[model samples]
Target: MLKKIGFVGLGTVGKHMAENLAKSDYALTVWDEDAEAAAALGKLGVKVGSSAKETAKGQDLVIVIVPESEQIVFGAEGVLEGIDPGTIFVDMGTHCPETIERMSKEAVKRRAMFLEAPVWGSKEHAANGLLTILAGGDEALLGRCREPFSYFGLNIIHIGKVGDATRMKMIVNMLQAELLVSLSEGLVMGNKMGFTPDKILEVLDSGGVASPLFHSKGRSIARGDFSRNLALKYVHSQLERVLEAAQKFGLELPAAETARKLYAQADADGRGEEDFSAIIKLLRR
Candidate 1:
């Protein structure tokens, strides 16, 4: 029954998700720091808000997706400033569970509902509406957002209460980062053994280790196309968050720690802006 939507953040993934949402029956208002990003959505008949506050005003739901954890959501001019009581605020960006917990408190103070529904998958999955949504909060609240979510999510999983979705997202990102690093090492060893990257991919595709992730990333990495589907810097940051959480729980993740160092080296080498799979370039060296 939530028909009006306020969407903030129109970066690489957000823009496409908003574009898809615009196709639905909901009345959509969008805002972003980037005027050009907002303009593109405006051209699609989606109302463009002059500010985050304006976008959030008079909406059934205010959705935020951005890099920063606190400022972009609860800052002076952020969505919290314009959200009406009873309006739901859903954060779809990946962030640490601690940050999300702080945000939940602020939403409670304002008498507004908060739900953390960080997504899994990357830019292409977002564009195609195949992204999986890991939702955390009241199940009834999640059910209300389900229709709008369907506009951009192929899978919607209810993941416990307010902070659980972010924790799950970090866990998923950790595995994704580790697997990509593992693949990078495999491709590197194959190259050193005088096999082509494509040939290595062919053999991997035929084996027990085969996966859609390996197939997609391996082919793009083979073609030397490191265009950004998921930025390496974000992946590195996620791994860092995962390790930090692991330490808090008195756990050790040897593979993730090593993968973070490799990703860190690539980030330091100025490959942070490239696709996450570009870490293979570091292994090649």
Candidate 2:
């Protein structure tokens, strides 16, 4: 029944998620560093707050979906500063588990509830309210927030307790990175072997290895359209986090390490802001 919502972060996907929330019956107050972004949300009948602390103050629920963990937990005028005791704070961003654990401890100290609920999907999915949400925290707390989540999430899965969502996101992203790389390699090799890009896509799509990602992104890659869906830079960051987590457990991921290098090359080539499918461009070069 927590209807008062304070949302921070208004980036590509976050903005759409916030918009879906604004459409709900819940009263929403939002803040972002980008004034233009905040203004856009304000036009949707969402009350715009001047800062993160101001946004969190007196709200029954605070949701953050930023790129970096520091911005939410330790940045100037962060959410931690103004959230009232007993308010629930949910982070639906992909970040380091350790950072989220630290934030969870700080939330407990403030007598506030915290949940890590990283999501999976592109900006298109977010815009259409089809994103899959992986939540990690007290199940009771998640139950309290389920209705609001239904506005934007097609699936709300309880992964475990705090930090588990982040770990799950890393695992998912690692596989995503590898899959994209494998697709890129296959396309490039087929092209070199005299098969047209369209032919390659047709073969892949008609086969068992086909997926929604391959269907959408493969067509785009074949057509040389690298417009941003999930940016290469963010994928590269996730790969780094995955490798870091693997190392902590004395594990080796040779495929992920190789794919990370390709993504790094794409970023260096000024394709960081482009779709992750642009890694195919690196292979072509």
lDDT of 1 by residue, 1-285 (tens): 688999999987999899999998889999999999999999999999988988988889999998864556777778888888889999898888777887788788888899999988878899999999999999999999988888889999998999888888888899999999999999899888999989988988998999989999999988889999999999999899999999999998999999999999999999999999999989887
Q: TM-score per candidate, in order?
A: 0.97, 0.96
lDDT by residue (tens digit), candidate 2, 26-83: 9999988899999999999989998898899999999999988576556668999998
> Over the full model, what C-alpha lDDT does candidate 2 score relative to the true structure?
0.90
- Show model 1 residue runs off by greater than 4 Å: none
List all candidate RMSDs to the true structure.
1.1, 1.3
lDDT of each: 0.90, 0.90
Residue 104 C-alpha lDDT in model 1: 85
Model 1 gets an lDDT of 0.90
Best TM-score goes to which candidate? 1
